[model samples]
Target: MILPETTTVAADEWVSQHRYLRDSGLRFFDLLVAVDLGDQVTEVVTHVMSADATRRAMSRIEVRREERIPSLVEVFPAAAWHEREAHDENGVEFAGNGDLRVLITAADPPPLQRSAALEPRVDKAWPGLYEPGAVSGATRRRRPKPVPGVNEEWINGGRQ
Candidate 1:
């Protein structure tokens, strides 16, 4: 029933406060869910259930880009897989989780940011330094080889 400020709490604080939930008769960590916001933010939802109705409750958290929050796997063993899924799919970092890798194992990148993939990749266009002809203020010269069969005399024939 405690709602922390900013929807995210320090890992240590969270674990300490919820330690009792472990022994509160909740046998299962139901799921770790996430909602994707196009601009690189996701809302995370963690669900837990107790065999007794009075203790059953849900916890919500938010994960943002460039932020690392603690994972609940230590408090709820069942959260291991859920944390992994959140990390893989939504790019949420579960700070304390030892393993951080894609769950699906496909070569494709995460689906969270589809627009980035569709955008053109222009960085590889130039290998190293810019070529003279490729940019302004660049000059180019071409030299033609002499012809073997026709002598200068024949070519200049009548004129000279």
Candidate 2:
């Protein structure tokens, strides 16, 4: 069967929505995570289940890349670790979480971010650097594509 739909909410309403979920019988905190939607937005996902473990629901909230969100540690203390992982992996900042320290990579860029920003490989075609389905596996570079950081214009408007 298809999974139940997840409810999406604004970042500001996340904590309250989660509290509502708990009051509505979804008292089990399954997980809390985040997805990198480029540098502009990050989608945080939350899953909760009924105390009887028979019902469940998922919720999502989007936060601007440079913004902070309140932590749910006060509600579900177990969420501290999951939120930390999201912060470590996707560069999300939970406002009330005292431990936003990088859990995995303390120095490297977020693992979920675009690899192109960190590694320049014009010689080797990456998945999104080219048109979709243009190259299945590995293909020789036929032309010199614009590099993102070499020229400021490339990053601004040169690529287009």
Candidate 2: segments with Cα more than 4 A from true spot: 115-160
lDDT of 2 at 53: 75
Candidate models: Cα lDDT each: 0.59, 0.74
The positional error of residue 101 in candidate 1, measured at the CA in angstroms, is 2.7
Output the number of the TM-score-best candidate.
2
Q: Could you give candidate 1's per-residue lDDT for residues 51-75 as a string of tens digits? A: 6644565566655677777777788
lDDT measured at residue 114 in model 2 versus the true structure, 0 to 100: 48
Candidate 2 residue lDDT tens string, 1-160: 3456899887778889888888898888989878777657889888899888778888888888779988998888889999899888888889899987767786456877543244343333343345454566777466347555343333322343
